[model samples]
Target chain A: MFPGKYQAVHAAALTVVLLALAASGVQAFIFSDPGSLYTAAIPDSWIYQAYHSTDQLAVFYGEGDWDLLYFEGLGKVADQSVRELAERSLALYGEPGGLSGFQLETPLLPVEVGGLQGLACAYTYQDERGNLLWEYRIFLLLPDGEGFSIALGSNGPWVKNNPPVLEEVLKKWQWTD
Target chain B: MAVDRLRKLSAWVIVLLFFSVIAAPVQASAASSGKAGAARFERALGGGAVPEILKQYGGEYVLPLGQRLWVEEVFRRLVGAAERQDVEYTLTVLNSAELNAFALPGGYVFITRGLVNAIGRDEAKLAAVLGHEIAHIEEKHGMNAVLRQMGLTVLLEVGMLAVDFASADLLRLAGTTLLELISRGWGREAEFEADLVGQTLAVRAGFDGSGAVSLLDGVLNLDSEDLPMKVFRTHPDTQERRERLEANLASFWPPPAAVDDPQVLERLNGGRILAQAGRNDPRGRYIVSLQENGAGLHIFDLQLGESALWLEGASVRDFAWSPQGQYLAVTLDEVSGDAVWICDRWGHVKRQIDLGRRRASQLSWSPEGKQLALLISDSGSQGILVTYAEADALVPMAADLGVEYSTWLEDGLFIFTGDAWYCISPPPVVPVTVQNPVPQVLQRQRILSPTVIKEGSTIRLTRPSLTMP
Candidate 1:
């Protein structure tokens, strides 16, 4: 026997649950845009910034000291592996001024991302003012030899403090297709 | 309608089974791929038989349990510090009395017990040696050499087979090739690369960055006819490598100011010892030296003409006497983990600290004698920590100078050697000061050795007086 008061309560609970589900659906749709070729889990705390290029996206987080960069592009140079291309691109962008302090903390090692073989490296360098910064770069090779590179850069202290969160985000990264 | 529903149900079941069959294996393969590759590599290298084969050579020594643990701990720390978690390293000690260390593919590193004994149980030297071998593995020198010997088609086939790869014929060929490479060593370029890589790892692991240089010096001092003379053949041109390493070290971390005039110090040699403190006490002097067999430490009282055995049984790696001559800090070599003993002048152990399976080499007593400064290796977690040891507290100084040698100044400050001579105030506050304010010039002049001289109630440091431009 469903009392009138109980029936009203059940209907309200159902509506609330449906609304929550719809809200999450909307959030996922917004993050995984249909036009984008890749999708990754970004922490709710991060603020989405402008896309630098058609293939590159940047997001800022953590007291304005850290940012996550994503890039996907076809092979521009001939006869180079995804690892080489990624390293070359990183060296160009990471050390634009040909700085001397750039060091690879972790060499290019095998990694599995989005169920595909990938390569990853961690590097550290000092700015002109001598502030230590670290970056972890992971590159996933595509079937057509295109590559997707993800970079997480921040001060040393912040990266050390957020290992688990960073690992989770990398674990959830995937190709949209 | 019933027939149609049954057909739909059967199709759904078939599709579900297909997904399960495909997905389960893929997940399993992904989980076990790395382990399987490692296992295959191990099998190809003859598994446990590799150590036995190495023991066939005369003078091979099996490490005691404690020493084994110590070696493993050090290796683990080095690998972790290098951030190379992909390869699993297995360290083996040959019981032979040969000063040699080498690496094999599949994470196998071998160091002779004689080599450890020869280096006087110095941990930094050990780290440098281990780091060099590890660099060989990380850089894939052995594997690349083998692959070059064999064709690329074989490697491709081996790669394709993955976990189920090992072939007996291929293993035999690979094993023979590895042995040849080990005997002949990698190319000069590879060796140089290994030296740089090893130095980087050793420095990063909080070891004395000069460890590689020290090891090379020791090697150079060895008799040409020694059994370890094979090192010359395997590692060609030691003097050149040493020079390169010295240059690299200087660039990476500049040398501290010279503590003594090399010309003046070079003239006198006989009775003078490398005393850490009390260089100017004319009335009497204390000198610490290794026993004839390098088994223990001997403290000689020059004034009294008496010598006392400070520590015996284990090799004395390093030691320091307090400024006031009240206490002595001595480090003992072990296969497990080295121990640092705080003892009185009469050789009575007051406090013993176990460094848990890694090397604790450099020790410096605070000027006031209330605290002892220790250069402790942090493996990979932190570089080296300059720890202040008091009666019941072990406080780590916040300075990250990668201190190689440290001494406490009379003014309650500590001078540590890293890129240069930098002074830091004692904890609970550590403020750093560079001894020389001038920008370092890249000249290759021989540095003066630091000496403490006393003149009329004043302590004087007789270091090389450099004219700043």
Candidate 2:
């Protein structure tokens, strides 16, 4: 075989291998729940945990390691304001059965949830078994009195430094109902 | 020359990507079919081994001979009514306080003691729970996970839950522990089907189908707070299960006079304990610990050895069981600031009292189990406050904040503060706080803790052994 032909063949094979690796690793995705409870553009490489997911909860893990993202749909929080719900949620998260060592990273702010007016708060906690640093974002939807949260817990520092993948997720998230 | 090489590379990449999509081993969200359905499921994990492993997770409760006969008889009747008669079903009672019932392949149906206690004497409710498990086994839902990724990381947690669909899923869950899987749920569609079939079997077995409703109601009682919580996190989510079952069974809806006397079969099976608040309610079988590091309070069933309730926010500085072992007083470490929670037998927090800037310790219940006496240490001094666990404020024996002493008067129990000794029962001689008498009357029947006596302005008491501070 000619050296030029050999170089082209080698280049082609390498391209295919890299493409396969990318497909198995950081793949593009969309999640549509069977019950039509939710539809969202899942963050790249995030594996949706269907068994753990429920009508009220959608759990996703990213980074091929453990960058956890939880989309929890808390229905009809009565007459409480988003801020109040955020406080109660923090309290619940700080309760005995909830996350460990949940400390507020910052005061709650008004933000957008799937493009809705919502209350946003950031807190840090160790996992239930007193595991690694877990930072969580609570988004209480002002409309419908419903709320969802996006929490990112990690055992590695890479996830903390990377721009949150949830930015794309929330940008594409939509309520099917 | 470079452009020509890039074109060749691009052509190969596009062709490879096209084939990958077609050949990808990813499972579709839909229920699989054809050969996938017919494939041999769990050659080793399928049969009796699954139940034994489950029994290891949820330890077995060997019932008394007569009571065992009654439950077995109930199981036999339900088995008689079920459609799949080939599978010989066996019922194993689990010594767990969590309201749970699960079926393993090979007809092994397990029910927890919590369900038994919650159902009390209602054989029908027991039948409803047992029937659900039986339906799961008969439908083959219990054994239907085919091998996937045959060479992947197999997490046989306790040599349980390995190399199958659940374990296959486990490969992706880098963060999900077995506790999270169990705490969240198994699945929904299969669970809902089990409910329908289970209720049908129960009705066919001469038990009221509404027993499913009452049985779920008991779960609601334990899980009402929507605590995304540890308790009553059923396979299909409890509230939805009840609604779905109710909608499906709407024709005969609530069977007339279905308000069953749950106490009837209860007494026949040798007297189950009904929780009368403020006394030693025998409903508590799970023991709790602020496991060594003191950050999380894990409630472990004495018999099951499984941690059912995991309370994990701050260090549990102190904890004490009520005199009757019906309630627990837990003082959380001040990482969340000072507070004490009055929790039920199952360790679900019934009430949380914010202790301002001060901290509390030595959580012990007062005699007769009506009030909790905890030593509250403020910035200045530490003093004992006798608080009625039901109310937020301490029910002052008189007007002062501290319980100087406590005694059993002829009429009732009296606690002395700096001002006066107030009688707390046979109607309080000087009731300073609003008293709810029902539980107090029940507690008056017996001395649950060792003893307590009130002196002029001082009291000495001995608490139950497991008091933590």
Give per-model CA RMSD: 28.2, 33.8
State the interface C-alpha RMSD of candidate 1. 22.7
Q: Across residues B1-469, which tens digit of lDDT does each residue of candidate 1 receive?
A: 9999999887656545533533444344444446566556643573434755475645345553234435555676678777556677877777677667888776778787777667654666778899999898888787777655554334345553232233444456567767766788878888999998998887776665566776786667667775455655888699888777766653343323333444433432322233545322223466777677767777676756877775677677767767777777778876667778877665677777777765675566666665676666666322233332323224444235565555555534334344344445442211111111111111111344445776323467753222111
User: What C-alpha lDDT does candidate 1 achieve relative to the native structure?
Assistant: 0.58
Scoring each candidate complex against the real one, what DockQ results?
0.01, 0.01
**For residues B55-148, could you state the per-residue lDDT of candidate 2 as single tens digits?**
6546677653334545776788789888864566777787777666777555767777766666666676778888988887777664432111
Stretches of candidate 2 exceeding 4 Å from the true structure: A1-177, B1-44, B48-58, B145-185, B223-231, B250-469
Model number with the top TM-score: 1
Q: Per-prediction interface RMSD? A: 22.7, 20.9
Interface Cα RMSD of candidate 2 = 20.9
lDDT for A76 (candidate 2): 55
